[model samples]
Target: MSEADVTVIGAGVVGLAVAAALAARGRKVYILEKNEGIGRETSSRNSQVIHAGLYYPPGSLKARTCVEGNRLLYQLCARYGVPHRRLGKLVAATEAGEEPRLEALASNASASGVAGLRFLTSREVAVLEPRVRARLGLLVPDTGIVDVHRLMELYLWLARERGAELVCRTEAVGLEFTGAGYLVWVRDREGTYAFRSRVVVNSAGLRADRVAAMAGLDVDRLGYRLHYCKGHYFSVCPAKSRLVSRLVYPVPHPQGTGLGIHVTLDLGGRMRLGPDTLYVSEPEYGVGEERRHLFWEGARRFLPDLEPEDLSPEMAGIRPKLQGPGQPPRDFVIRHEADRGLPGFVNLIGIESPGLTASPAIARLVAGMLG
Candidate 1:
């Protein structure tokens, strides 16, 4: 049996960040990734937007961590030489009657400590985004985008440099308590292997509930219900791309799913719109070409001149949402000794949306729990 101070399941951004943070604290960390590569799942997919803590409810982990992690992530990206840009964002009230709702959003954001939200009038909005027609908009200067793949590589490199081991193509099948520690059963291309760890951190992304089940824990009872929401993205035409300099979003719906099918730019300045929420049964991580028309329709709401030919099917990602549509958003479930009696076992459940933004702070919180 291989022994380690800590074992992190799942090599997604959150798991990698946790491993890096734990390794930085002088813990021998082992990262077991079910896939052949890191972040091939939800991490690599989706809108690579560095959120500005705009829509999460006040005092929720999503709100706090996203607000805190946005600051930390910007600093880390700079310190580690990761490629990122704070291109800013605009939450616009496109409809005439939506201005008050936009104001409420600004107030909520202010309460969450999301700095630099400048309210723009209709003329000002037109000055900023010539193509956008909105009565009011809130410009978030701190909002940005990053090369998520490169950021994951940097985190893996740092963790490995600090003596952390990343075992790819390895899946944790089962786990059992061995009195002294936890014995984890992992299967790779070779076969099954048993490893013992003093601490186990379950950062499994979509399969977090399954991981918890294998560990002999009931996820539902622990306030975890995996409601998968799939989002699809569509590519934007180069000519119409420069229509906006910053991320443009419509005021989020009361459902908590970011509504506006706003435009987002890649690190290379290419633009894409979408990730319209669709509840799926299978929830496999792949884009449905059938959803292209849906994206076109959603895009037309904000970009009136958006044509169907302008949209090309891009990609899709699944969110491991713990709550259902119209339900209150749940805080990230980072249960250590507080909720679970088991020592040195932390289960991260329903870490969606601002999870990327909140990753660093979440890692620190995980480290503190482990200690």
Candidate 2:
């Protein structure tokens, strides 16, 4: 097989974005995906909300990339005519006890370079969302949703236009460092094959840790092990879809298991609630039918008008986590292992949440690292 200057594994949004960035720099980039198509997993099955750099710890990659990526994403969308909306978001504090978390989020957001956040009184929230009952609200003018498929399509198109080759259903099964470069052993419908590249980017999302291990990195020993945290979403019944115009969030779990069951509106104005976190033994994407009542109870905090039957199973996605239950939040691990005596190999693990928003920025950062 012909050698590539740079090869990226995993054709999810981050990998595709990384390819786009590398290709733009005139690198001979190639992408391989295990799935038959891009975004078959966590990329497409997500909240699809453009986070406003609000919930991450200060100085973390998630914070920095999300802040910058959010800005860059809007520009890319506009440039490529990608379908999206900066329709804004409202994170509400429905109970008095939750108001402290609101203050902390505002402070953290400001520290993370998020601008134009304004606290709202109950009356103001009532004016904006008549059905929402909250004692206080935080309006983030920058949060929005995009047609993610279109966004990925643009990235793939841009990469291809720049001479990057993307082959779906190609799985990288082995990685070994050599004098010439890194050898990537891959398999596809045709058969197993191998190629060499000066740089290898492991953006394999849920399987990122395994990819790292293929390069001789001791993931568990290095604390780079990935925990699969599953989150479920339930779309609101059409009768109640008009109940929200903005993304309405309850106070996030204090431990950051996942964002609480909150309301999100698609660009089409349909509402969905979801994403309670459950640590699973495997990478299961099945929505728990038994958890619908829990969704109703949690979302009913601010969405008081929701009936028990107002929600139904929508979808589920798994997060590749570095932090497990009750652990302090973990930052994304994106490092070129030069210090490990292996240069030009980058590992990205636990890139959940703001990953979609931060994808472009991440690509640029990778390009800069290679530079």
Candidate 3:
């Protein structure tokens, strides 16, 4: 069996960040990725927005990490030449009566310690985004976009530089917790084997709950069972895409299932709208052309000029959510599992949206947990 000081299951952004953090702390690390490459799943499939810690409750992991990670990620991107933009974002109150909701969102963000938030009047918003129609706007300067591919690559490179090993196309099928450490049972094209480690971090994005179950945890009983929430994105035609230079969003969903179909620009400034929430039994990435109207209708509230034909099915991503449909928002579950008789097994579950934004902070948090 191969041996390492730490084994991180899954190679999504969070896993890579955790591996990098632990390795940087002088812990020998091994990253096992089931896919052919890192971040093939939700890591590479979403809007890639660096969230501003606006929506999560104050003092929650989502808020704390997002705010901290926002700063860290900006520093990393600038230092490493990662493709990114601090183009900012606009949370709009498109209708007259919606200004109260916009104010509430700002208040929540303020309580979460989000800085550089400014309220803009309709005239001010129009001055900044002529194409948008909103009664009021919250200009969040910390909100931006990043090239997730480049960010993940940087994390992997950092980990490898610190003497970490990445084994791709390998899946951790089962985990056996030894008295002192863990024996990670894994499989590849060849066969199955075990990798012994002093510490194991289950960072499996979509299958985190399953990985926890493998470690003999009662996932369902503990509320670690994940509900797959699929969201679809539609790219705006180039002609219409240039209408906005910043990310534009409507008041978020009342239940917090999604941020509402709004506008997000890539690093290259190509606009896309999407990610309406739909709970699914499995992770599926098929985008229906028929849903183009939904995107147009949703964004048309603020983007008055938008038409259905401007949208084209882009991609779909699934969030490993802790909350099912109509359920209240759930905070991220990051625990060492020592209380449950597994000393060094850290489980990161329900790490959906803001996860990418919170990765670096999550890494630091995990490293501290292990240490």
Candidate 4:
């Protein structure tokens, strides 16, 4: 059996950040990843946009961490040579009826403490994104794009440098209360084994709820059950990829199902539209070609120049959501479960969108909890 001060399940961005934070504070940390490598799941998928804490309710964990994470992420990018761009984003109301939603979004953002947000009129929107057709728009200057893979690499490097060990192709299959901490049952390519840790962090991304259940939590009773929401992205053909310089989004769904099918630019300046939310029983990453028209119509409301032929199925990702269809939006659930009789067991569930942006801050929060 192996042992450590902390055992982190899942080596996604958040898990890596936690490892870095804990190890930097001199904790003997070991990161156990189910995959052969890291971030092959939700972490590698989805839009890599660094959100400006918009679109979330005020005083929520999503709002607080995103606002703080936006700043810390930028600093981390500069200090660690991570590839990123603060190109900003625009949430536009393409129809007169949608103006109220735009206003609400702006108000929510401001209430959440996001600075540099400017409400843009149609003319201002035209100046920023000439191709987009909108009645009004909210310019969020704090939003940007980041090479998430690079950021994850830096986190791994920092953690390893601080004596955190990353054990890949290892899955934390079970957890047993060991009086003071947990006896984590792990399965690797060779076989299964157990590790003793004073603390266990459940950062299993899509499988976070399952990990919590392993520790005897009634996921359903506590509302920790995760619903998989798959989002598909369609890439713009190179000929029409230059339609937007910055991210362009439609007014988000009122229930927060998604931020609507909009435009997202990668670090390479290529544009992709999509991530229409479709709740699934299990995780899947198939992007159907038939969904191209759905994406085209959604983008066409803002990008008037978009054509159906210009879109092609690109990729897809599954978000571990706490809310189901027609349900109200759910905030991230990050708490030390000591009160639940699982001392030193931290549960990070329903950490989806903005999770990438909020990773570092979430890590610090986790560290503070353990401290």
- Kindly report which residue stretches of model 2 are placed more than 4 angstroms away from their true locations once superposed: none
Candidate 4 Cα errors over 4 Å, as ranges: none
What is the C-alpha RMSD, rounded to one decimal, of candidate 2? 1.0
- Between prediction 1 and prediction 4, the one with superior TM-score is 4
Q: Rank the candidates by lDDT, best first.
A: 3, 4, 2, 1
RMSD of each: 1.5, 1.0, 0.9, 0.9
lDDT of 1 by residue, 33-136 (tens): 98998999989887888999978788888898899999999999999888999999988787777888888888998999988889998899888888887788
Candidate 3 C-alpha lDDT tens digits along 246-317 = 999999857668999989999787999988989999888999998988888999999989888988999999
Q: Assess candidate 1 and give its lDDT.
A: 0.86
What tens digits encode model 2's per-residue C-alpha lDDT throughout 1-371?
59999999999999999999999999999999998899898998888999999998879899999999999999999998998999899999988789999999999999999999999999999999999989999999999999999999999999999999998889999988996689899999999989899999999999999999999989889999988899899988898999888899987868668888888888888888878899998987788679989999998889899987888898898988899877887899989898997799998889999999999999999989889
Say which candidate scores most in lDDT: 3
Global lDDT of model 2: 0.91
lDDT per residue (tens digit) for residues 219-329 in model 4: 999999999999999999898888898899999867658889989999988999978999999887888888988898899988888889998888999999999888989
- Ten-residue stretch with the least lDDT total in model 2: 250-259
User: Which residue segments of model 3 deviate by more than 4 Å?
Assistant: none
- Candidate 1 segments exceeding 4 Å error: 337-339
Cα lDDT over the full model 4? 0.93
Provide the TM-score for each candidate, comma-separated.
0.96, 0.98, 0.99, 0.98
